[model samples]
Target: MPGALAAVSDPALRAAFREWILRVADDELVIGHRHSEWTGFGPDLESDVAMSSIAQEEIGHARAFYEQIAADEGSDVDRLAFDRAPAEYRHAALLERPNGGWEFSILRLLLYEQFEAARLGLLAASGQEPVASLARTLVREERYHSLFARTWLERLARADAEGRARVQAALDSAWPDALGLFEATPADGVLRAAGILGEAPEAQRPAWEEAVRPVLQGCGLSIPAGPAREGGRRGLHGPEFEEMLAQMTEVWRSDPEARW
Candidate 1:
């Protein structure tokens, strides 16, 4: 990793470059797995369908990012995803947080999709053609995700007294880690200096906050303020990830060498 950083002229820029890209990939995998639990069990038929689509898209996005890195390193994406230990995962605490209620899950999806959109937009213009191209294609899928998040957020927030409160509470709980998405790393400076990415975490973070703030406000929600609880980018995550990992790899682990 340090060798990759040394390739960049600046320390901070390279760290930032790696930080965002890795964070993006980890967040998607964790959240996608979380959401996949609702495949046949959401609040209603339409909702189940919508949430399943979101879950598939998120996992698909993660596969795209993970496969790229795997291809670069001659590794296997399936092993990277399903066979890894929890501590090895780089996803955020927020992604591993349990889905309490359907409304809460919807709210979580809303916030996550928003963050994913901005993250991909920045990546799409990184001047790293291959990575940037992946980001561009991801944006196409993320657009659908945003539309789903917005529809559910607005509907739930305005539906009834209980619905409004539930969505609001979900927002309050998720806000802290939403900011955690901006956590920086040692490579931030090198990415920019090497022209591998567009902006450092220091620069991209506030812009992301500003951009996301309006969306929250427009949805009648409050922005969270706190020292962001981090560690997701550093391969630190919540306990829920362990449970999720077991479930995700259960069938695959049953017969390691068996072919379908």
Candidate 2:
């Protein structure tokens, strides 16, 4: 398939596509930072190295997506990734939240990896050239992310009563934010209308639920019933996000003109 930019000349559609891409990139960047927090602090040496690698892969993924947008807009990828205001980021609130505990981070990773795999599947089938091809390539790495998360989740859940309780508590706290992953935006409608996106994030919820429910249930964890915490997609986020973004962007912001 031809690149969406070549196939679809509509400026609005292109803008919407850029917005959607930003959301994907932002999710990766934020979650990658959160994952990096586990680098030296993981429960074990193997897990530490594994999570560090995952963090690098995720940040690399974000850079790839940002490069796509930068190519389209004649902008700089570093600026796109590091200079955006906190409210300008389109990532779900879940990714920006603090990594509370090993259980919390593991469960969050499990939930997110499943959603990401499904989202990438949609992108791969969208026939939007570089983006579609990129999505396909990403799935290769994402599979291992899903595997690591699931394996850790199962181990933590089965470790003992306290372990199970901790995992359950993390689920209760994270489920609402996870559901926030599918919050919709006006740009999503544009992508759907342009045929660049087959399904809006909200529309993908059922399948995501189907994919996650069994894994979570198998761990003996109950899915929490709470309202989806929305607003990140629309540029609303909490102070914690502000703090994290500051830390993430500190060096770049301090020396924007310097070559990294």
Candidate 3:
């Protein structure tokens, strides 16, 4: 709403850009909530604090994106975030899945951070206004997230046979949904055609793979052979997402008019 999107005069282009922004915001918000679940339950004290900090940052990022859309629509970030129904969300299914365990959470974080970094890079080069500048600023914060995940991933993978096995199992389980992060939509095509987006969402997959594959392989993890899980981008989520959404929006739903 900082007039960043005003130059995109075409209604179709604006709609597509808004959808893309919502997708990014939703992804961050859902994953941030998932990460927050570990606040008091992390395997160790440092990890607990670190995950909490990461959760705050992710949610903050979500707010930054949501603010743009909300401002454009004459709404508020809290309304855009907490007022939406489960099926209205556009986050990848990978983010909504249960944290499972420390290893699972770490592996999930590793995958997501890599994907986010790549996507942000494309956004930075998109020649868009405030959004591109915002992407550049967000990239600096994301570096710590990547580093945290990588450090923990390596330690867990090399800890022992059981640790390595656990990490591997996590990778196998998460890979399919991780791939779903790049599931393409008409919005992606629209953005690409408008020159607002440098690459379609699906086209960013290889770059994400290139970034994550080496780090994962270095940790002795094998990439899983599975098809990408789809639907989240289209607002089709599983029951787990329903439950999470119910919990996430409970307070807001209880009193939508109340300021938090």
Which candidate ranks first by TM-score, i.e. highest? 3
Off by over 4 Å in 1: 1-21
Measured by TM-score, how close is model 1 to the native structure? 0.87
Q: State in Å the error of residue 162, model 1.
A: 1.5
- TM-score per prediction, in order, is 0.87, 0.96, 0.97
lDDT of 2 by residue, 63-90 (tens): 9888888776677889999887788999
Backbone clashes under 3 angstroms, per model: 16, 0, 0
Q: List model 3 lDDT by residue over 1-260, tens digit each.
A: 36356667889889888888899899999999999999999999999999999999999999998987877678888899988778899999999999998999999999999999988888789887788889899999999999999999999998999999999999998999999999999998898887778887778888889889999999888998979999999999999989988898888889999976
Error of 2 at 8 (Å): 3.9
Error of 2 at 64 (Å): 0.3
Question: What's the ranking of the predictions by TM-score, best on top?
Answer: 3, 2, 1
Which of the two, 1 or 3, has more lDDT?
Answer: 3
At residue 57, candidate 3 shows an lDDT of 99
Instruction: Write out the backbone clash pairs for model 2.
Output: none
TM-score of 3: 0.97
The runs of at least 3 residues in candidate 3 whose Cα sits more than 4 Å from the true structure, single-residue gaps closed, are 1-3
